[model samples]
Target: MSNESGHTEKLGIDDCTVPETSVSVYEALYRRRMAWDFRNQPVPRDALDRMLATAVWAPNHRLTEPWRFFIIEKGSAASEKVAGLAYDFALQRSGGEQRAAATRDSLLKTPVLIYAYSTPGRDEEGTKENYASVCCAAHNMALAGVAEGLAVTWETGGPTRHPDLAEALGAEADWTLTTMLSVGYPAENPRSERTPVANFVRWLD
Candidate 1:
């Protein structure tokens, strides 16, 4: 395949050593976390652009690049409308004014919101693969955020997947809404644990 410099390079197995860089890929993978608390400051546009650039590199079967991204900035009319929709959805689900208010407040606090989605494919299997590719693309953006010293979280629920919000964001009705990324500067550090790989792995001879 042709590389960035317009040189054709054959793809083949190479050494296992990490590439030389200020931040290693493994470090980014390890440091990536779902950030809930944010500093309420706007993230740099360049940082977000970097994240989107990496997102397009996600692998997809048959190379059906189907991922799409939408950004919502804080304090904008769009943001206010989104929060209002979330409030309405929450009120319907919980039937509590306090809970609905809390949901609106939480969304308003977010500095930036990124919605990732996938375009439908030709058939059922193709559509499923496209959805998976979009998911990978979203994770790529999250990892890129970590490397850029930004916080990111993938959020999805009734409020986020609401059709009204999707229409407001100009997403097509037929496309799938994968997840929304809440991006900002970190206000807190959170830690989590994962089950051992051996617990879920199987060896086949």
Candidate 2:
């Protein structure tokens, strides 16, 4: 029997799925949401790899595929020591309390810590276009995570924008860390309510 706490089941095949052929574009647009409150249980690496692989398939203006993804596995981190030390340094400089430090540790050491960066001015129109492209990539990644049964949260925080942190990761000088993607199983499932699309769309000639 499954647990009744809205947090049972693993995030691999134990998750749910929708038919690729059955869903329409509008339906997909309506389906996406930002999932937070991830479970303590880690998402499997193989599943994450598959979802990220699918995320890069979004359309790009130059076919540049300008985005770069950084993933850190929970309970098996590659940069935990560095990230922890960085958190301490940041707290000292910003005069932030322990709660902020705790949040930083949780985010930086989550099951998947994805940094999506893109070179500035690569998209021609302006920084906005470059950012838009990266945003599209992020949305693709989030949707793919959802399809894989992972709960994800996209966080834009001070660390993501820090020049020193970017340098430590060896991110390119022109690359902006637009957002950090966290992936894991849902800690709790809460139904979402959204404004009707009719409020936003228009058919003008």
Candidate 3:
């Protein structure tokens, strides 16, 4: 199949088989939620890899796939080191030992932490495109995780803004920290509210 962009692709007949489920794409869209409370159970490595594989397929202008992910496995030395840095960063930012400790504990308990970074393009417009593409990739990962029966949340707060954290993640000078995704099994289903599309969308006929 080919679209207006003239990109041709072929799919195997076997690949067209859909799983027997009532969940449609729209259902998946509505069902996916940001999860806060997570279980200590680990997400399988193959499942995580599947999520990432789906993530990289997100549309990008000029095929500039600038997204890069750093996976910090739970209970690993790298995870501990990253958690320590995060704790220090949180303490410095909030000036609360208790809060920092809580944050550290959460990081330690989470099964996977995927740090996303984007390498800037040649010009300002190109850089913006790269950033947007990275956001789409993150969204892809989140939705894919949801489909795999995992809880997922994207965080772009302290770590994304911290220079030390970026350095620790080995991001280059031109690369920008985009997001950090926490993926694991849910401890509980947290309800979320979203404003209707009518509130933000405008129809032009």
Best by lDDT: 1
Residue pair clashes in candidate 1: none
Q: What is the per-residue lDDT of model 3 for residues 1-205, given as tens digits with 9 covering 90 to 100?
A: 6978899664444554433445566766787887778888889997887788766678889988799899988999878888888898889999999998988888888899999988899999999999999999988888777778887888887645655787787768778888889999889987778898899998999
lDDT of 2 by residue, 92-204 (tens): 67777775587567765566677788767734575666677788888876776666676667778654654466666667777878788777777766468879889999999
Question: In model 2, how large is the Cα lDDT of residue 172?
Answer: 74
lDDT of 3: 0.82
Pairs of colliding residues, candidate 3: none
TM-score of each: 0.88, 0.74, 0.87
Against the unseen true structure, what C-alpha lDDT does each candidate score?
A: 0.85, 0.67, 0.82
The 10 consecutive residues of candidate 3 with the worst lDDT sum are: 12-21
**lDDT of model 3 at position 21:** 46
Pick by TM-score: 1 or 2, better one: 1
The sequence of per-residue lDDT tens digits that candidate 1 reaches over residues 1-205 is: 5999998654323422222346678988988988888996788897788788777678889988899888989988988988999999998888999999988988899999998889999999999999999999999888888777887898888559565987888989998999989999889997889998999999999
Off by over 4 Å in 2: 1-31, 76-82, 85-94, 122-127
RMSD of each: 5.3, 10.7, 5.2
Worst 10 residues of 2 by lDDT: 10-19
* Candidate 2 lDDT for residue 60: 67
